[model samples]
Target: MFTFPILAVHKVIARGEADAAANGGFRNPWYGTRPRQGEKPGLWLVGDEGIYIISNGELAGGQKPLVFYSDECHPKGDTDWWDYKHRHFGGDDGIEFIDADLLVPSFDRNFGITHPGIRLTENDISFSLITR
Candidate 1:
């Protein structure tokens, strides 16, 4: 197992609903950018620093957001913070918002980026992959 501390959580200022869904609703400043120094098929545990991602040992480069998470910037409205664990570093599974906090945050932050009209139950959500 390899561990990386995400000191920054960038905000995905979506142009619209479509854009947010494409990003798994959250941004990690360090996921695909830096070169992978660990083994492939590895488990990433995501918490305050335990967010786990299954790395494939590839560098897809980094992302630059308008604002980043710090003591200064925090979630607004009903928006709250949540962590995502990708089954595959960057895969299609990355789109779905799987965690418990998905519905409320997605609705508040992105205005129903996870699912619009449909009310999502816990079973409806699944693990997401980190998008590029």
Candidate 2:
């Protein structure tokens, strides 16, 4: 039996209805530009989509991951941070958000984006968001 490892990831800011979560994140960060060695994760606006997560190696490169989790940069929101994950990514976990559209890479890695009307649940792990 070959059991794939579960690489869970979450964003920093999660406001709006998502304010319930202390940070709306349960794991690491990965999004924006060329990911740093250990940079924190976050998205654009608050609760942009539904929060992003990638497991089963959904976002990985040639051992040169472009998305990684950091502990730094956890900005506080004026009225409570509520945003989605990064959109364009190049790693095992790419999470991003956009106001126009989310049909890009981030949405692929994550089943859905974070938004005032969106939310992340255990059911997210029910399906594989990565492409074959």
* Predicted structure with the largest TM-score when compared to the true one: 1
Which tens-of-lDDT digit does each residue in 72-98 have in candidate 2? 112332222122233212112323332
Weakest ten-residue segment in model 1 by summed lDDT: 1-10
- Local accuracy of candidate 1 as per-residue lDDT tens digits, 32-118: 454432222222222232222222222324732232222211233213323222222222222221222332344445532322222
CA deviation > 4 Å runs, candidate 1: 1-38, 49-56, 63-132
Candidate 2 local distance difference test against the native: 0.26
Number of clashing residue pairs, candidate 1: 12
